[model samples]
Target: MSEQDLAGKVAVVTGGGRGIGRSIALYLARAGADVALCSRSNGEIEAVGEEVRALGRRALAMAVDVAEWEPVESFARAVVAEFGRIDILVNNAGGGFEVTPLAESTPQGWREAVEINLFGTYHMIRACLDDIPAGGKIINITSGMGLEPRPGNSSYSAAKAGAHMLTRCLSLEIWDRGIDVNDIIPGLVATTNVDWAKDRSSVESVLAEFEGKSPPFAPSERVKHPDELGELVLWVASMPAGGPTGQSFSLARRPF
Candidate 1:
């Protein structure tokens, strides 16, 4: 409602079609950043772009699969061409139920998870490296599970943990260049994924049995919302000059 940081900046949010990604995109736009939204679906992302424009900031929506190198590169180039430069990159497009036990998981499923969660992030980071100028920021969406392993989420946990490390490594490597890189480990947030499970009686049954707790831990007293995560992201991305970098922060109150 008032003038905020990130005004006149340009940001790209992968998986900006819906859920947390959509929240992040809108948050940035509201803060006055020209935003580019990308996802595998054009319609949903375009809808998000419309919201960005309504916020009085320029918007571009592109259908892109971050796992694919070519499309990722093209998306980066398009963002630069349309906005002139990239000031922020949010690698948020990664998740799935395929994080089953190793014995029950298929090789293809394993690779797919890794490719999308790990390699996809790599592609976007690589493509945007040159476009990110001094004072730019890179934020990777990691899972709390990545900080502490989830027994049944081998694939998801591995990829996210790798991504967390990747963020730190990139931060160290690029700090001298004046680019900041950080990772956020968000705990359970009520998103469409949770909604889908709620629709399926089986998922609901499982959840009910757990008493709202993640495995290996007590039931979560509260679940975070997507917009909550988005707010934290917008704040960090729009941090004033000399803000912290090469660090990881968790959204949940869990002691870690």
Candidate 2:
């Protein structure tokens, strides 16, 4: 694809304040797409919006909690009003809110994980579907844990697993509309979300801790940079119209 492959397009990235969302948002902007991004962090979202503007693209940043239908609906309206249409939507706002064992976890906390990871994705897509004309792309950021269950992360696993199926089901339902819906599994990323330290500011700094070795979770797996996922997302986003849909693209060494 050319450097300006996404020129004139508008992309919406959730959890765009930092980590994978931050990288993907900037990558789309550098490729010539105007970006509309949101996250719960007002300062982080606004900072990313400025970065997009600095790269010479229009940007709309808001403090939106993707799990809430009202905010998501409002965001969709704002995007249409500001950018006129939505060309790409990246559903990346997710987390293991309560990482306790399912048997011992509180009902609300366990459900909150599903609410954010799965319902949040649904809200963004439903809200923006009308504005996304033919040839639009919807990429859901999934996880290996979703494909295969992980201990103490039952809620996130269940939520992402649901999203995985949603991508496939949505693609089949929307095939006639010419939209491509797919999943991106960013395995062992060095995002603060994965790091136990909770210090999520710099991707490179986190990766540095693992230098020439692998992360503890996977003895043979090397942690990946957030920018690498950006590259993969760019490739998927740059695919020709009417291209592949309902597929899972992964960046991990281990098999899912």
Candidate 3:
């Protein structure tokens, strides 16, 4: 808040309607960047867009489904036309429709998982690559489930794993372009998608339930708020040229 570190930069954020995406977009806007954000929900994204404008930064809100190429391509074109260039690209539109084990999961749901989580990230990068100049940044939202194995959520695990590889490969291919590509592993965040927070009335309640001994994680592990991720993203985005690329910045204390 003290310094407008991202001033005059143009940022494009997918899944900007809510949760982590919304927090990232707002953080960028607060740092004085213009934002072009999209999600499937018109009203939700529009509301976020208004908030950006209120922060005295520009906003372009669109209803987009990133899993589809045509719309994403069109959105990229529109962003270039409206904002001139994109200094930051955040690929955040993804979720697992089927968390069931492979046998119990419908093929439709499994494919949906890959299409949105893996293919969607690729689509955004391909669409926006040309418009992103040197020194620009592409941040992919990744998951620990991708780096490891998930018993009941194989589909999501595989999809995120694919995305993680894509991030690394793309970094090697584009490092010469002066564009830094990396991933952010958010760890255990208290979003609506999380089981513990889904039924809980507040984040406080969720934290209380997990206090002293959070399951599936070490007892010392603590759940994070979406804003914590926003702050982490800002730090990464604020890094100067020649910083770490092809690396996954993890919030979790996993040894791996």
Candidate 4:
């Protein structure tokens, strides 16, 4: 698609202050879409908003925790108030509280995981359902761990799995409305938020390893950059009203 395929459209992205969300927000802006972004961090979202404006697109940045319904609903309303309509919704804010065996996990940890991943997506979708027009798109950023079992990250995996299922169900439920719902499962992406020290490898090495594996979605055998994922999001968001929906796209190697 061209950079202006999404011209005159309005998009909302949760957790759009940094990392993958930030990339997606900027990409949408570059593609000629006005952006409304929310995250827990005011500074990050504001920075992103400035970047969006630099691209000659309208932008609104607000502080919101997607786990809570009130703020998400308010955010959705605010976006419509500012932009007049919502065309794309990207649910990208979520993380694991802890990586540990179920027996060793705290109840709070599990709850936090579920709330941030599954419920967070649900809240964003529900809040914006009415605002989205007939040809709207919703993309959820899940993880490869959700597709397969990870011994230590069960809580997070379970929540993402639930989100994956929700994507399929919502796709069917909303098909009559011309809304498409899909999930993107990223594996071992190198982002600023990742702690390289914990992995005992440089970003270059990680990229090399990932490329050598010949992942399914990456035929170029190159490291998957955040902006590249943003390109994929743009493709999905620009799909025709009756195009593909209820699908899961993965960017991970086997065993991820």
Total clashing pairs for each candidate: 1, 0, 0, 0
Candidate 4 residue-wise lDDT, 105-143, digit = tens: 999999999999999999999999998889899999998
Cα displacement (Å) at residue 115, model 1: 1.1
Cα-based lDDT at residue 144, candidate 2: 86
lDDT of 1 by residue, 103-153 (tens): 999988888888888898999999999989899999999877677866876
Clashes of 3: 0
Order by TM-score, highest first? 2, 3, 1, 4
Where's the lowest-lDDT run of ten residues in candidate 4? 194-203
RMSD of each: 3.5, 1.4, 2.0, 3.6
Cα lDDT over the full model 4: 0.85
In model 3, the runs with Cα more than 4 Å from the true position are 1-4, 198-213, 216-218
What is the lDDT, from 0 to 100, of the residue 128 in candidate 2? 98
Q: TM-score, each model?
A: 0.90, 0.96, 0.93, 0.89
Top lDDT hit: 2
Q: Regarding lDDT, does 2 or 4 come out ahead?
A: 2
Candidate 3 whole-model C-alpha lDDT, 0 to 1: 0.87
lDDT preference between candidates 1 and 2, better one: 2
Pick by lDDT: 1 or 3, better one:
3
In model 1, what is the error at residue 60, expressed in angstroms?
Answer: 0.8
Candidate 2 residue lDDT tens string, 1-256: 5744999999999999999999999999999999999998799989999999999999999999988999999999999999999999999999856888878899999888999999999999999999998989999999888898678979889999999999999999998999999999998888877645345567777788877888666887877888998989989998888889999999988887
